[model samples]
Target chain A: MKEIVVISGKGGTGKTSITASLAYLGGKDIVLADCDVDAADMHLLMQPDFGQAKDFYSGLIAEIRQDDCIQCGKCADICRFDAIPVIDGKYIVDPLSCEGCGYCPRVCPTDAIDMLDMNVGKWYVSTIKTGTTMVHAKLGIGADNSGKLVAHVKNEAKRIAEEEDKEIVLVDGSPGVGCPVVSSLSGAKFVVLVTEPTVSGLHDLKRVYELVDKFNIPAGCIINKADLNPQVSAEIESFLKQENIGHIASLPYDENFTAAMTQGKTIVEYDENNLNEILTQSWAKIKQIA
Target chain B: MKIAIASGKGGTGKTTLSTNLAAYLAEKQEVVLVDLDVEEPNSGLFIKAELLREEEKYKMIPQWNPDTCILCGNCQEVCNFHAVLKLGEQIMVFPELCHSCYACSELCPTNSLPMVPQKMGELKHFNSGTLSFIESRLEIGQEQAVPLIRQTNKYVEECFSEQVIKLFDSPPGTSCPVIEATKDADFIILVTEPTPFGLHDLTLAVETMRELKKNFGVVINRHGIGNDEVEKYCSAENIPLLARIPNDRQIAELYSRGELLYKKIPGVKEQLDLLIHHIEGLESAGER
Candidate 1:
């Protein structure tokens, strides 16, 4: 099975919208994976009927048992993140500040610290209105370990695709060159980088392109909002040529994107004429290349 | 007061609002605009800042000294990220994957592991009139951004002792980088569009600020194209709508060319003026 992940280093470059359109045009059997767990919005467009939710755990967090207490203050002294707070002569661990390095558990002389795996978020396997399987997740607010959660979502999507004998997995990856983006790009067969025609767009595209190069993965570019600035668009096209990256498509800025979004529908589902043809063409090119 | 502008999703005008707001506030106040979106620090493009200095930020990664007699696998066992690998008599360390937690070094049996500094990003300082700007740029292909962001914040706190108008352009998302940028701010400006995806991610950003217990307001961009669902949600949640910048093609054109939109946009300067006043009013009220 070939897995294709749509990513952009800069956000709001129409990654989700383009992924939704491709899913719609790719028939009704492709497995969808939305690895942007921090802001998973593909479900908004897909309207997935979610099944049972499973809690996902990642890394370990130290919890101080206050009852077995002698406030020796050893854990507080050795803690790197200063997560152990001293309040009114009592010591406690702030879960937000803890990095789960497994230090306090080993340093506690009184054996008051118990390190346990944390329940960071949840994942779901659902079917969209178009009868496509979608694997998505939600990471808790202020929660760490988003990279692991994204890996979980992708793995589940791959498993379901194998079981159902599917061939392609269309993934909507998170923004930036952080851990979550790394996990999303880890094992994907092909990457579709969707960006805009702006200075930030070109700048961040280079950064993500470098990351894709590091992974030694083949990638293509789709310049969203291509008409915003003709000069920058031309510059982006040149850069793609210099880097030997394929230019799959260029989509002009349209008010229909926001209109369809406000109406809780995909652009193809709303205005099927102008935008649909461009999107279907891009999808065809992607399929041919992948 | 320190103000951080953030959004849960990218390309939502965080840099546009931050640069324009800093330029507007720099007229009367000593504004330090920090582009903390290290992965893609684009505020420098909109605001012209004379280069002052640049420094490379480093994090600790383990270096194994394998000549301590015993070839125990303790370093590999304690590494949470699997950065340390034991291959019979040799060890391999992936510095990029290391979290700099010091777990492997602390647990090394024969004291053969040493924590060494590895450069991860660059911190830049620039001077633009009265606006002193700082921006962090993570090296391409690096995974750790929170440390560098925190380092930039620390540099700001140390370099400036007196009170100044600090505006942080945070990375898009409610993850580690966003938390690092917004955690210490006195107030946060949550930028969003009027579309459904905007509102959906705005809710997550709001939840993050609420969890941090930081005061914040929302600024709606591309106002005319999308519906009033964002405004309705803001009013329902009692989140003050600071300002709304209309969806103007001219403004988008100028922004795409890296032009500051304060004076160019028809009513943007006035809107930013009012937004600054509202923030100062909130700041004083908090003091009271």
Candidate 2:
């Protein structure tokens, strides 16, 4: 199956909204994957039924047994992360700060520390309202290893697509050029970079495009709020031409995006006029190229 | 006071508020603005400053030495990040996966796996009068942001004093980078819009801040766009609603042009003043 991942280097550039609209347009032929495990929100619009779930265990966390009568401060001394702190005269492990290096347990004289597999998040394989399977996940609050969870979600989506003989896998990637975004791009056939016509938008687009270029993946661009700044829009068009990235569409700034989001609907489902036409055409262009 | 402006969702005016707030506060006193959003830092776009200093940052990773003949797999066995691997007769180190925990190097019996610094990113210090703007960006394809963020925080602590007001433009999402950016702040301002996506991510950010036991408040941007659920949720949860930046096209236009809005727009200046007043009240109340 051919995979097409949508990403935005900067946040809140309507990446999820556009991805959801594309999924709706794809209907049952596409298997969807929400790889934005840090802030997975496509499920908010996809309305996936939580029928299949699995615990996602990644890395290890140090747990101290309090009954062992020893507070030698050895574990706290050796930790690079300030995960272990003396709280109320007892050494406590802050899971959020722990890197799980497995050194503290070895240095503990009392053997009070144990490295245990951490259940960092949960992944779900469910059918959405559009009669297509979606592979999504929710990372634990303040948890690390989001890249692993994203990889798991993408692999599951690709596996299901191949098994069901689906033609495409549509992935909604995360913001930023970090681990999660990198993990989501592995083995992807094409990339759709959604951005805006703001200074930050143009700045971040170059950074994320550099990453996509490093992976040697063909990419397309869509300026979501192209009319927000005409000058910046012109600059972005020139950058797209110079970089050889396909300029698929330039969507006008519209309140229907937020209006549809507040009503738990995609713009395609909410508006049947200009936005619908633009998004439909955008999807067609993506299909033609990707 | 060190205050961090963060949002669980991106493009929620974290950079907008941070840059303008720093500019406003710098008018009277020395202020430090650190953009901890290393992955895609945009605060530097709005700040017009003279380049003061720049330095490349590095993180320690294991470098395998083939001269040691033991061929023991202890380095690979103890590493938690899978950055080191012992394949047949050779050992490889992947710096991107390394967390710099010193587990592999310290545990190596033959000292074959020695820790060495590898360039990860660069930090640049810019000065515009009383405002010191620091921006650190991770090299592209670098898998982790926490190490660079930690280094940037160290640089700030070494250069700036505690008496000056410090504002951190934290990265979006409730993950390691976000936690590292806000963990040491005196207070945090969670910026959010008024939509479903905003509320969902804001709730996640709130849970994260509470987990870290941070003193924080909320600011609503694009105030008139969607329903009042964000305000309602903050009230129900007793989260102090600090300020509301209205949905003004003028502000958007100014921000799109990479201009500080508070200087040009009266409404933005009013919100910044109210936010400063609230912060001063927090300081007097010892919330700082």
Candidate 3:
């Protein structure tokens, strides 16, 4: 199955809205993966049912057994993260600060600390309103290992796509050039970079594109809110030309994006003519190129 | 006071608020604006400051020493990140997956795995009058942003006096990078737009801040475009509504050209003033 990952270096650039529209247009032939586990919002639009849920355990967290009488501060000294602290004369582990490096457990004199797999989040495999399977996850509050959760979601989507013989796996990637973004881009057949026409937008687009360029994946550009700034839009087009990235489409900034989101609908379901045609054509072009 | 301006979603005016707020406050008092969004730092694109210094940042990773090596497989077993693997006679170290906790180097039976510094990113310092701007950018293809952000916070602490107010423009999303950026701040300003995506991510951010137990307020950007659900949510949650930057075309145009909005736009300036006033209130309360 061909995997088309839609990513925006900058957030709130209509990445989710556009991805949802594309997924809606793709219909039953695609499997959707929302790899933005830190702040997963695709379900807000897609309305995926959380029927099949699984505990996603990644990395490790240090748990101190209070039964073993050890307030010796040995674990506190070796913890580089400062995760262990003396609270009311008892050494306790702060779940948020702990890095689970396993140094404290080895140094504990009484063996009070045990390194256990942390249930950082939960992933779900469910059918959305469009009759396509969506693999998404929600990261626990203040939890690390989001990159692992993103990889889990992607693998599940790809596995289901292969099993069901789906034509494509459309992934909504997280913003930034960090670990989660890197994990979302791994093993993708093609990339769809959604950006806007602003100073920060272009700056981030170039930065994220640098990451994507390292992967050697074929990429196309979608300039959302192109009318907001014509000069930057032109600059973005030229940059696309210079970088050899395909110019898919330029979508005008519209209120329908927010309106549709508020009504829990995709742009394809909300707008019948203009946005529908553009997104449908964009999906077709992606299939042709990817 | 160190104030961090962050958002749950990107392109929601973190840089816009950071640059303009620093500039406006710098007119009277000393301020340091730090762009902690190492992956894609854009505050420097707006601020025109003279370069003070530049430094290359590095992170410690395990380097195998063949002479002192023993095939104990201790490093592989102890490593929780899957960064180190002992295959046959060679130990492979994946720097991207390593958290630099020094577990492998310290736990090795022999001193086979030595910790060494590898170049990861660069940190630059710039100055414009009383406003000092610092930006740290991660090298492309680098996966970890927490180490660089931690180092940048250390640099800021060592270089600037405690009296100066520091404003950190943090990366978007509620993740490790965001946590590292806001963990030490005296207060955080969560900038978000008024939309479903905004509200959704805002709630997630609120949960993160609460988990971190941070003193934070909310600022609604692009206020006129979307619905008022964000305002209602803040009211329900009792999160302080800091200010609302109206959705103005001129503001967008000014921002597109890398221009500061508070000086040209009256609406934006008013919001900045309100923010400054609120910050001052927080400052006095802290002193009390």
TM-score for predicted model 2 compared with the true structure: 0.98
Q: Any idea what lDDT model 2 has?
A: 0.93
| lDDT digits (tens) for residues B71-189 of candidate 3 | 88999998888899999999999999998988899889898999999999999999999999999999998899999999999999999999899999999888788999999999999
Off by over 4 Å in 2: none
lDDT of 1 by residue, A1-290 (tens): 89999999988899999899898887666899999999999999888888868999998888888888699998888776778999888898888878888767776788999888988888999988678799999988878889999999999999999999888999999898888999999999999999999898998899899999999999999999999999999999999999889999999999888888777788888987879889988989999998
lDDT (Cα, tens digit) per residue for candidate 2, span B17-108: 99999999999989999999999999999999999999999988889889983888888888888889989999999988999888888778
- Give a tens-digit lDDT track for model 2, residues A151-240: 999999999999999989999999999999999998999999999999999999999999999999999999998899999999999999
Candidate achieving the largest lDDT:
2
Pairs of residues at least 3 apart in sequence or in different chains that clash in candidate 2: none
Per-candidate RMSD, Å: 1.4, 1.4, 1.4
Candidate 3's C-alpha runs over 4 A off are A67-69
TM-score of each: 0.97, 0.98, 0.97
DockQ, all models:
0.77, 0.83, 0.75
DockQ class, candidate 2:
high
Return the lDDT, model 1, position A19: 93
